[model samples]
Structures are given as C-alpha cells and as structure tokens.
Target chain A: EADIYQTPRYLVIGTGKKITLECSQTMGHDKMYWYQQDPGMELHLIHYSYGVNSTEKGDLSSESTVSRIRTEHFPLTLESARPSHTSQYLCASSDLTLGAGYNEQFFGPGTRLTVL
Target chain B: AQSVSQHNHHVILSEAASLELGCNYSYGGTVNLFWYVQYPGQHLQLLLKYFSGDPLVKGIKGFEAEFIKSKFSFNLRKPSVQWSDTAEYFCAVAPSSGTYKYIFGTGTRLKVLA
Candidate 1:
C-alpha cells in the first residue's frame, strides 16, 4: 500500500482565484513529483523535487509553482486559476534506493480541480 | 525525446476472456518498463514491472507482461479477465541511468462485462 495523501479530493472554484493543492507522504521519500492529467488522457509531468529545498520543472510546462520546505510535504500553488487549469493532479513519491527493485513510484489518490 | 504509446485506447472484454494490450516505447537505450492500474476512484498502483533479467514479468492480480527488446514493445496480458479487473491501465518507461523520471502512455480503458 502507498502512504501518499492529497487533500481536497475534489475542488470547485471560480476563475482568477488562487488555489493550492496539498500533497504529503509518510514514507519519507527523497523524490517527489506532480503530474497533471485530463480525463482519459496521459499524465503529464509538471513539477518535481529531489529533496527538501530542491525543485525542478518537468517536461510539460506548468503555470503552478511548488515548494518543498519539508520532506514530507510538497504543495503546488496556482497564482490564478483558470478554466484551462481544470484537471486531475496526481502526486507520487519514490525512495532514493538505487537498485532494480526500488524504482516503483507510489501515487496519491489525486485531486480533481475544477475552475468554473 | 522519450515517449510511450498504448495501441488501444479502450478495450471491452467479457468475463473469462483473454486480454492483451499493446505498448511501445521510443527510447533506444535500456529502459525499465512498468504497468500501472487505476481502478475507479482509486490511485495508480503498480501491477508489474520489468527491470533486467526476465523478459516475462508477472505482476499482482494475475497480470503479466512480455518485454521484447528488439521491437521496443512491452505488451500486457492476462489469461482471463474478470469484471473486477476493469480499470484504466498505463504503461510507463524510465531510463536505467539513475534518472527516475518516467514517460507514461495515454492509457487503455478496460471494461469487463459480466
């Protein structure tokens, strides 16, 4: 079982409002990632962190910003929400063990965000 | 550029029917392949993965996948599918060079009718 968790399993907000999606893990993983997905579509990487205070932008460009102040918490913030930003956001974390059997990532339940 | 493709966008199967879903990757170098399943209202979970040794890897829930290096294909298969197996399946690949970033396919939606 995965220990990752995300708050506000579903959200509905008006356009231009700022919103933050919360993600946290109890497994004490060193690597964390955020992915965006439209309904019935492939997941696109948006943001990731190697460790506390380390962040990098993923392949697909995203308007949201993420912070890694604590190893267990990685929060994504959208300055101004828009209809275009409506999608399901998934959070995943993986351990730092460098080996064949340890590369699998554990995913959170995901947050379904809707900007009206 | 690395990318993954799932040939089937949606699949419908009757109970006790054999199942196969095609997946191909564009990376030339060695890769680690993974098959993940997402049930309704649930998070993504690893069904199985192929790392190095075996070309055929078995995952949880009676799922298996064969990795063909020459074809750059890792196709998932099940001997017989049940209605409980209905879900969205995703295929992902990551290079073995210590980069943990994964490229995922669009996913295949499986519907099993009783």
Candidate 2:
C-alpha cells in the first residue's frame, strides 16, 4: 500500500482565512509534489521538491506556498484563502534511487478545500 | 512546449465489453509514459508505466497499454471491462532526461454499466 497520507480530507472555511494542508509519507521518498485539480479537469502541478530544503514552482502559477523541512513531510500553506482556491489538492512522492527504473508516484487521498 | 492529450473526455461501456482509451503526447525526445487510474473516492494510483524495454506493458487488474514511439502514443486497453472499472483515467509523460516534471492529459472518465 502507498504510505503517503494527507490530512483533513475535506475542509470548508470562510474567505480570507489562512489554512495549511499537511502531507507525509513513510516511504522515505526524496521527491515530493503538490497538484491542484478542479472537477473534471486535469491536475495542475503547483509545487515540487527534489529533497529537503529544495522547492520549486511548477508549470502552473499558484498562490499557495510549500515547505519541505524533512524528507517525510511536505506541507502547503495559503496566506489567505479565496473562493477561487476551492479545489482538490493532491500530494505525491516518488523514489529517486539510482537505476530503480520506477518513476511511478504514490499519491495521497486528496484534500478537498472549499472557501465559502 | 511538451503536452499530453487524451482524445476521449468521457466513455460509457457495458460490462464485459472491450475498452480502449487514446493518449498522445507532443515531444520529439524519448519519454516515460504512464497510465493512472482513480476509482471513486480513492486516490490516483499507477496502472502501468513504460520506461524502457517492451512496448507492451501489462498492469494490475487486467489493464495494459501500448507505447508507440513512432506515433507518440500510449494507449490503454482492456479485453473485458467490469462495472468496477468505472473511474477516471489519466495519461502522463515525462522526459527521459532532465527534470522529473510530468505532463498530464486532461483525463478520461469511464462509466461501466452493469
């Protein structure tokens, strides 16, 4: 089973509230990613980390920020949530072992956020 | 810019019917193709992947995909689908070298009727 986990499977908050989504994996994967998916649409990459202390913005511009303080944990935070930010957030992690030949990402049960 | 395309937006099928979903990518270099499935109320999981070696790769739950480099296509197929197979399917591509970023298609939602 994929060990990745995301907290707060569903969240509903008023606009202008600050929130943080937590993601953790027991697989010890070095690469972690955050993706935002709207209903019936493709998932857009928002942020990714190659390893601890290394973070980069993905192709899609996102207002949320992420931190990778440890190999097993990566969390995303929104300074001020808006109705436009209502979407499902997915977290994934992949191993970077040499010659593993497996780039398959293990995903967490996404967090559905609603800003009212 | 590289991009992935899933021609079928939604598909409907009856139980025991054959299934095929089209996927194509626009990139000149070698790539790693993957098929992911998301059951209702579940997280996305890998169905199969083609990194190197054989063009035809089989995945769990009787799922398979063919990688055609000449056409830049990696299509998913199943001989007989079950109602439990109802879910959303996503196709993704990653370059063999450089960054590990993946380009994903819009996705195809399949509903199998019993």
Candidate 3:
C-alpha cells in the first residue's frame, strides 16, 4: 500500500544534540512539505520541496535544514537542537497537476521531539 | 498573505448533540477550502473540501460544510455528533494557484462525552 512514513515517531534528546528526522513517501508525489506544530497550536510550515533538489523555506523560519536528494525522501536535520526545537513535526505529500484546482495532502503520523 | 481563523479553541459537548465549527479566511480572488481532522495518535485527514460548484459539500463521517463566499467563511457542521467525533479539527485555505501551500487555522479541540 502507498503511504507516507516518518521514522523515530518519538524522541527525547538533550540540548545541543544533533538529530535528523526522516520522511519518505511511496505515493510518488511531486510536492512534499514539513510543518512544525506545538501542542494545542496551529501547524506552521517550515520547509517544502517541489521536486528532487528543489527546496524552499516556508513562512515560518526554522533553524533546521532540509534536503531533497531523491524524489521520495525529504529529511530535516538540526545541527544542534535546542529546547525550543521540541515540537511535533509533520510531513505531507501532494500530487499536483496544473490547473487542477485543488489537491489534498497526505500526511504522515508525525514525529514528536522533546529536547530536554 | 492569506490567513485562516478558527473561532473556538476548545469545545465540549455530549453525544448526539448538534455541532458547528466556525472558520473564516482572508484572501483575495478564488481559493480552495478544506477541513481536516486529527484523531488521537492519528494522522491528519481530510474531512471535506470546497473548490467550486455547490457551496454545500458533504464529507465522510456524516460531516458537511458550507462555503459562504460573501461571508468569507466555510464552517463545518454535523447534525448529531457521536462520541467518536472527538478530535482536533483544522480549517485550511489555499489560493487557486495550483500550489500546495496552505494556510491553516488554529485547531479546535472537540471533546464529545459519551
């Protein structure tokens, strides 16, 4: 079955630790996004990729960086994580066609990170 | 920039009670509207969407929403909600530019008591 997956669903690490959150999709989507969400808060887009090697920063500035080396994988990495970096990170993929009006995003289960 | 607003932060209701969640957006030109629900420990999934045509759109789990263009609102409603309806609901709006960027509202946590 085709689905989006994220590794390390829950993680707890001390401040200044380096971490990488993995996201992959089998749905063969052209568009991928990464969002950061705090408990009981709205999600904020942190990064997005239109296709392989095409990365763009989103509305919310994030300390982490993302690279789309392959079409199926978009990983976010934090060189030195801080306590404020603790949040649920969600990854989503969408198949978009020009003039298609709208497209629904398929979301992953999200990775919850706690930086102590 | 486009933005979305959700009226309620938290709501508590008994099973079988009527439900309505308010959503509003600020955007110019045509836009696509959507409602997404996230159950406990589950991924966020689409409940309904409004692109064009009929203003009233029906969705899974007996959920529906009406797109009132004049009021710039797309509100979700259910005639009678069940205990399983408890979840976090988010309203999103995207400009019809064939892009996947969406502006999401602060979610509303709905608790339906059985």
Candidate 4:
C-alpha cells in the first residue's frame, strides 16, 4: 500500500548532538509539511514545502530546519538538539487535487526524539 | 496564517456510545477542513473532510462531521463508537493556496471502553 515513511522512529541523544529526521512518500504528492508535538498534546506546524526547492517556516518557531531537495523527500535537521527539543515529529503530505478547502493529509508514523 | 482549535483534550466513552468532538478554525478567506485520527502506534489517517457543496461529510469507520460556516466550526461525530475506536482525533484547516500547509489542533484523545 502507498504511504508516507518516517525514519529513526525513536531517537535519544545528548543535548548538543546534531540530528536529522527523514520523511518520504510514495504517493507523489507535491506538498509536504513537518509538525512537532508533545505526546498527547496539540500539534504545531514547524515547517512546510510546496515542492522541490520550495520551503517556508510555519506558524510555530522551531530551531530545526527542513529541506525539500526532492518531491518525495522532506528532511528536518536540528543543528544542535536541546532538551526542549524532545518531542514527536510528524511528517505529512497532500495532493492539491484534494483541493478547494478539502484538506486531507497523509501522515507518516512519526519520529520520536529524546534529548538527554 | 491560519489556525485550528480542538476542544475536549480527552474523552472517555463506553462502547456503543455516541461521540462528538469540537473543532474551530481562524481564517478570513476560503479554506479546507479535515478530521484525522491517529490510532495508537499508527500514523495519522484522514477520517473525513469538508471542501464544498455539502456541510455534512461521512468518513471511514462510520465517523462523520458537519461544517458550520456561520459558526466557523467543523465537528466530528459518530453515532455509535467502538472500543476499537480508541485513538487521538485531530481537526485541521488549510488555506486554499500555497503548499496547502495544514494547521492542526492539539488533538483529543478518545478512549472507548469495552
């Protein structure tokens, strides 16, 4: 079946460690997004991309950065992980044809990050 | 910029009970609305969506929602819920353009007891 995939499902690293979370989709969607959440809490938009070579910051201010080098892959990087950065990062994408106020999103299983 | 808000941080219901979750959004122009459910250890999946034409929409697992434009609300409902329905439900909104980036509510954890 087609789906979005997130790598490093679980991660535990020192406060200063650099980390990258990978996301990919097989459905060929042109739009992708990254969200951060504290388990059971609300999700906050951190970054998003329209297509390859296009990216924008979300409403939430996050220290991490994301890149869309390819249409199917949108990776998020934390230059210096902090204890405050401990959270679940979710990856999602949507095809625009689902359009006109019809916002259905396809999400990955999500990557859980822990900063010690 | 757009935003989504979901009330009911946590909900507990017995099997066969009815379910409803509140959702609201802030956007001045046209937009899309959706409901997504995340089962334990699973990815978030779309339950249903309301784009246009109809205000009420039915989704998988017998869940449905109605978009009240005047109220600025899109609420998810299920006539009868099952224990297997235990999961987190999120309401989302997105502007008509851009990357179609979505703004999600915090989420409501629904626990359906057997």
Clashing residue pairs in all predictions, respectively, total: 0, 0, 0, 2
After superposition on all CA atoms, what RMSD does each candidate show versus the true structure? 1.2, 1.1, 1.1, 1.6
Model 3, position B88, has a per-residue lDDT of: 98
> Scoring each candidate complex against the real one, what DockQ results?
0.73, 0.73, 0.78, 0.75
Model 3, range A2-97, lDDT digits (tens) per residue? 999999899999999999999999999989999999977788999999999999999999999999999999999999999999999999998766
**Cα displacement (Å) at residue B80, model 4:** 1.0
DockQ winner between candidates 2 and 3: 3
Model 2 TM-score, 2 decimals: 0.97
State the RMSD for candidate 2: 1.1
Tens digit of per-residue lDDT, candidate 1, span A27-67: 98999999999877889999999999999999999999999
Give the worst 10-residue stretch by lDDT in candidate 3 chain B: B94-103
- DockQ value of candidate 1: 0.73
Better of 2 and 4 by DockQ: 4
What DockQ class does candidate 2 belong to?
medium
Q: Between prediction 1 and prediction 3, which has the larger DockQ?
A: 3
lDDT of 2 by residue, A1-116 (tens): 54999998999999999999999999989999999998778889999999999999999999999999999999999999999999999999997556645589999999999999
lDDT of 3 by residue, B12-45 (tens): 9999999999999999779989999999889999
Off by over 4 Å in 2: A100-102
Instruction: Report residue A11 deviation for candidate 2 (angstroms).
Output: 0.7
Better of 2 and 4 by TM-score: 2
Clashes in model 4: which pairs? A42-B106, A101-B32
State the TM-score of the second chain for every model: 0.98, 0.99, 0.97, 0.96
**A12-109, model 4: which lDDT tens digit per residue?**
99989999999999999888999998866678889988899999998789999999999999999999999999999999888766335544788898
